[model samples]
Target chain A: MRTPLGKVRNHGAGAAGTGHFIAQRSTAIALAVLAPWFVVNSALSLKGGNYLGAIDFLTQPLNAVGVILLVLIAFYHMWLGMQEVILDYIHRPFTKVLLLLLNTFGLIAFGAGAVFAVLMVNFGA
Target chain B: MAGATRPQRPLSPHVQVWRWHVTMLTSILHRVTGVALYGAALGLALWLMAAAAGAEVFGPTHEFLLSPIGQVALYLIVAAVAYHLANGIRHLVFDSGAGLQPADASTSAWFAIFFAIAAPIGLWALVTFGG
Candidate 1:
């Protein structure tokens, strides 16, 4: 029995599965640590009361880096999570192919958008 | 007996029927937390796009975020963040082939429960003290 309190047992699921699970979890843990910072930074950002001011605040170390890292980690974790969902739900040959394609492209888009926004902030200032 | 026979419906692996266990609860909570966090991510995206695009968009998004509904949603999202994180570690142990025994399952499950609760409470305290 795979009980949490007893002496830990082996999952016997093999290295490939364990590796995927571990990676999904590792990114998720990073995201968990990062989430509050992003939320608080976001909530505080609205206080400045103007476009330029919001931009200005984001230029600050805490907000700028907070947002940049937030975007990367969030998207990475999400991509990993979504891939599992797609694998479970989409069983067709062609549709699964497309969904996999979409997941990869979507993550890339998210990363690019985040980088673009940060660059804009830095250069626009 | 035939006259009194009852039909049995297919059951999804839901809360009922199965004996409730900590690992099971934590597993369900992880999925719940994940979906909730997705919604939160959407809200974040809106706010980000607004901030990037300028005041015309930022004004409405900002107002919504500070509203009662928005705040509640924000709170749930953060709470889910905590749950998912803690539960995620439990999963990590399972992933690493370390916590598959029933006793270890219970122990790690409790550990996740405590960790999850601690984080959101910490966030709420931050909001109360600072916001």
Candidate 2:
């Protein structure tokens, strides 16, 4: 049970503390498995290639799906990591709050843009 | 407590006060790489957008990536990723309640550092020379 002071100070997790921790790690584990594949495949796809070839490779259903997953998960993980870093290092309360908001919004925008790009490629739009 | 003025707190010991060590280097590198990856997200998004947008956009993007400066950037990013990934695995190992021994921890840090160097170099060797 949180008191008024706790609520005012934002002491509680707003029901997200444990879930955020678990999700960050889960995404990290997922990335650990996916990242090597991503790097290798990306390099291979681009071997002696031009722009259209790059598009062709990415638009393939398998590559498109893999990339979409990678972008979303990576951004989510990045957001969590950035939030932690900012909270740890930024001592000014106002600046910390601003940076935290920027981190969240910025990641969301990147994730949305990346997924949109992948979908555009997938659909040949 | 919320309404009262807070007392000034002592700053914790940081890198300035500490001697260099492999484990400390690894830890700092993890955070640094994490921040770099966050910035790289924008580059990635731009790459994807260009790809989806067609050759007019992707041509320049791909060209930049193959250029000397771009290749250098790519190599650094890849190195960062390798380090972060390898150290992340070490962290997971620690989380599992193993590798708590100082000797084992140092060994793992060295392993992570070695992997960070080797992974990108090995990857590029394959990319460049593999038939």
Candidate 3:
């Protein structure tokens, strides 16, 4: 009974890196930079003490930029990071591809809705 | 007989047959919670953008969230947010190169559960009591 050389060899090379691991860390750094400013903006919103007061504060030049930045960064972060999670555990290839497309559309829809909202806030319509 | 016993297996049978571990549960739940949070986040993204945009867009969503079903959805989102946020901090800690030990892994898992549950309760109290 001879043991084959192939049997002695191992099979560990298939372990690979995915986009989620990298993107999550990348967006982690972005969130660290963005979160504090957002906290301050949130506090400011409360301070307005009334609807139009809140509206006026939101319409400020810097505040508008901050809100836009927050939406864009946050959605990008969520999309990329979540794409990673779906790919990892949901092993069926078709389901995985479907999820990827669903996620992409989801992000786009979110972006559109947000843009619409920003337009409403900025233009007061 | 003890020494002569059949050579023990190098690894446990069925990494599948292995006990459902805390670390494993935490790892999976972190990702699961992430998907839930993404839905909630889409809502938040709109809210922020609407805030930027003004009343026409903002009012309806604001009103929607305050409604009964919307409140329930909002509550779930709040729960997801609390768990994800706390678990995220745990990942950050691991990213920093701490908690590599087996004991540390289990400790962190417990911590994740504790924080996940506690944050929501705290938030629930504040939302109900503060308002």
Which predicted model would earn the best TM-score?
A: 2
Docking quality (DockQ) for each candidate: 0.22, 0.66, 0.32
For B1-131, candidate 2 gives per-residue lDDT tens digits of: 75468777776768687667778888999999999978877798889988878878888888898899999998888898899999999998888899989889999999999998998899889989995
lDDT of 2 by residue, A17-107 (tens): 7887898889999999777778888887787789778878887888888888899888889988998898899999899989999988887
Give the better candidate number (1 or 3) by TM-score: 1
What's the candidate order when arranged by decreasing lDDT?
2, 1, 3
Looking at model 3, residue A38 earns an lDDT score of 56
A15-114: candidate 1 lDDT, tens digit per residue? 3566666677777778767875676665555543567777777778777777778888787787777777788788997999798788779667656766
Ranking by DockQ: 2, 3, 1
On the 0 to 100 scale, the lDDT of residue B24 in model 2 is: 83
* Higher-ranked by lDDT: 1 or 2: 2
- By DockQ, the best candidate is 2
> Where does candidate 2 stray beyond 4 Å?
A1-4, A7-16, B1-17
lDDT of 3 at A46: 44
Per-residue CA lDDT of model 1 for B1-131, tens digit only, reads 46468567676876567777777788778876775676566556556666777778777877776689977777677667767766776776676689899998898888878877676677667656666
Q: Report how far off residue A58 is in candidate 3 (Å).
A: 3.1
Q: Give chain A TM for each model in order.
A: 0.79, 0.85, 0.70
CA error at residue B120 for candidate 1, angstroms: 3.0
